[model samples]
Target: MNNLKGPVRVVGTGLIGASIGLALGRLGVTVHLVDADAESALMAERIGAGSRDVAGEPQVVVVAVPPDHVGAVIAAQLAATTSAIVTDTGSVKSKPLVDAGALTDDLSRYVGSHPMAGSERSGPLAGRADLFDGATWAITPHEGNRPEAVELIRELAETCGARTVELSVQDHDLAVARVSHLPHLMSALAAGTLVDAPASHLELSGQGVRDVTRIAGGDPRLWTQIVAANAPALTTLLERIRGDLDRMLIALGKDDGSGDITNLLMNGVTGAVRVPGKHGAPHTDDATVLVNIPDRPGQLAKLFADAAASGANVEDLRIDHSPGLAIGQVELAVKPASVDQLVKVLTERGWVVHR
Candidate 1:
């Protein structure tokens, strides 16, 4: 926090930039907002993100523009601002560095950072103050980067309620390609299957399809730039998936039920279970207790209160609404030992409990 001692200037007022402004503004820091789109900057300011006025030289300048524009903007800002650490929140790191290198040889004051937090929504209107809470922010400091500048960005991340992780420029690009870019592409590919699907077939779709294609709703233009920027890593991963898909197809064509498809499916289960659970920790074999909740005000609050009274702490939960139905199904995840007690208590309290 001490590293972020002075005023900050955010060069873009999009979701990430506005959210950062909102978070830092709450911390009693003087934040100045700017954007190529004046409307965006004004909207962010109206939302209490920050002020549009620039009083003096800011301590740090945050570049929150699109991935393609990050390098030039950061380069220009680095040259324009005196003694200010320039950092960008671009999802891809390596390409921006390459672009910035072409523009200016000096990068001693520039650090690349990416916050692993966002939604499918965009613009200042979709900005949330707590978007970065409990999120991991990657700080990629290259050779010749100033240690003091790196520390300033690290402290800035902490001030915004995010944990910091260090990664090299190449490593950051590779890691994000695997986890972030690949998933978006996969989701878009899956969702693309439904583009021309028969209306009858699409009507039969369930939560499975929705869950699988959720990230596909993101802005395609932005994603296209991201995918192209990290094409080398993404191509390798996509080839692996294609190989697996080809194997499954070959297995399906055989009359004899070989274990190829079975093994492939089982591998999916193993990988899915390895996905981190709440708070980015290792997954737990938590028991789920489902309760049918009526669509009524205060019903959810009451249910939670009852769960608290039952002395069972729910670790995690999700609510699924049945289309055209007036009720929702609440799945409360708890420690395996508390499942029985939770079910018993909810059932006794007139909740339609399901295992």
Candidate 2:
């Protein structure tokens, strides 16, 4: 039966776990939330994630503990429940499979799934039912799993509002290393350099620096377990990055290097555009409209209204303002064809518009 008939038992009450509970609750499915920290489970229940009553046998057991604890938790849940289709939300899949496999042999009821959605923030209060909306969820079903068990997990993911991609365990680990784990490590490395910078240098920071280092603010203790679990894949990618750095340094040391730095920058441009746009399709053909607004209430609402008046659908947006500044810049991303009319309308309406 490829159904997410609950009560679904969620073994952790952190952001991802609590968000899953909240999402399932929207479907009127019963969710039983548990955590090593009792207070965490209570907080998750308080935030409408789920109940902490631990009632009824679970139809599905979702192991959402930290990466280091996921395998053991999965094994324990399998033993505790007789017929539940067990799954996990761990970012790294292979390690948990190995760990759980070592602790037990009856893995026919288990599948590994990772919902590629989370925030740099953690804890139950950070949970939101829509966290997985329009997000990608990877499903890695080992050979030991029953066919219907895999389908049930797929249903579980879709019920939580995510698109699913099935890949082998090795492939999933490698893919996440390049797209997720490596990027976090890179962000951490970049952010680490600014730790001891002068106050004057820090004052010049803008959206560029914030964009580069945003994920660096993630919980280091948690990320350490993830990074370590996926170390084999990450090491390969990091070595390639090291090679790129060495070449860049050599090119920079030379005078007037022909096309070396240019080629490096071009490589970046080539890669950046290939990243999928917000709609999850492989397209990035959107232009930005910048409008200056007063840093006051209702300005954003008024700006959006003005943009809508021009018949342009704002695909994405960001607001930027330095500390102590009374004005802000709003970057509105709209389709290219809509940009001209949007800009003209905003400019005619007394907004200081820029491309």
Candidate 3:
């Protein structure tokens, strides 16, 4: 693993920021946590994110503040630091880069980065060292950017177990507007519709509804900042989706055997399958096994043990549990070739596997 020569400074000890600090600190590099909220910064330090004070000139500085505040924070950090290579973990980049350009004449030392990793949770207490593991981190270098500085930021990301991708700021924002931002908005909308739903309707909700609405539980304040910052791209994407939904509705209401609705639904299925998997590679033909696990201690451990003994690699997994359900569904993703083998192993071991 690559190491930094000097202490690394992390601004904003929220989930992403504190996570960067923790990951770097674990790699034997001294990390300095600088947040506008002193107590939060101190709490991050307490959780092993980094030290409390800026001891000296840091070699690299990561700005993990909210998207709206990223530009100002990056500018201030660049002005204050002696000569550190500065980067950010904000979700949107183009606007911040433009804002930074307006704030400072020296832009060579700064780079814009966004890690495609986060949970619905927020704050320093929610940070985990492995938050960036196997996730993509986009690095955007502008005209005045220093090659060394860009490489240093890449090294820092690699050390934190993130796969780095180079993209123009515009491309990054536009792409995420579809895959990330739009999804958050969709989930929030879907979840909001349930607010006035009848109690019986809510009780009937299955894993599918819950899965699609998970991001709705995120911090509203943070999301308000993100959605507002990336409004232009998100609005465009949403408009397209709106048009498609309108067409689908019209097609669904048609009495004649119009194939438009079927075609649209099929297109959505095809689009979803094209999404890359954990390693930045396309997922292969695979099957997911849903196991209803009892809500008790050691149930998850036993499930994993059976899976391991089955000689099948688990590509992905998700657990769905509600307040009153005695059982939670564990979705285990396995290669198509190994599905039968895993099913036999699981069934023979007496674990209830969903068909």
Candidate 2: residue 336 lDDT (0-100):
93
How big is the positional error of residue 46 in model 3, measured in Å on the Cα after superposition?
A: 2.7
> What overall lDDT goes with each candidate model?
0.90, 0.92, 0.87
Model 1 worst lDDT window (10 residues):
278-287
Per-residue alpha-carbon lDDT of candidate 2 for residues 19-118, written as tens digits (9 for 90 to 100): 9999989999899999999999999999999899967689999999989999999999999989999999999999999999899889999899999999
Candidate 1 lDDT over residue span 17-66, tens digit each: 99999999878888899999999999999998899997888999999998
What's the candidate order when arranged by decreasing lDDT?
2, 1, 3
lDDT winner, 1 or 2:
2
Q: Pick the candidate with the highest lDDT.
A: 2
Cα RMSDs of all predictions?
2.1, 2.1, 2.8
Model 1 regions lying over 4 Å from their true place: 294-298, 320-328
Clashes of each: 0, 0, 0
Model 2 ranges with Cα > 4 A deviation: 54-56, 322-325
User: By the TM-score metric, which is better: model 2 or model 3?
Assistant: 2
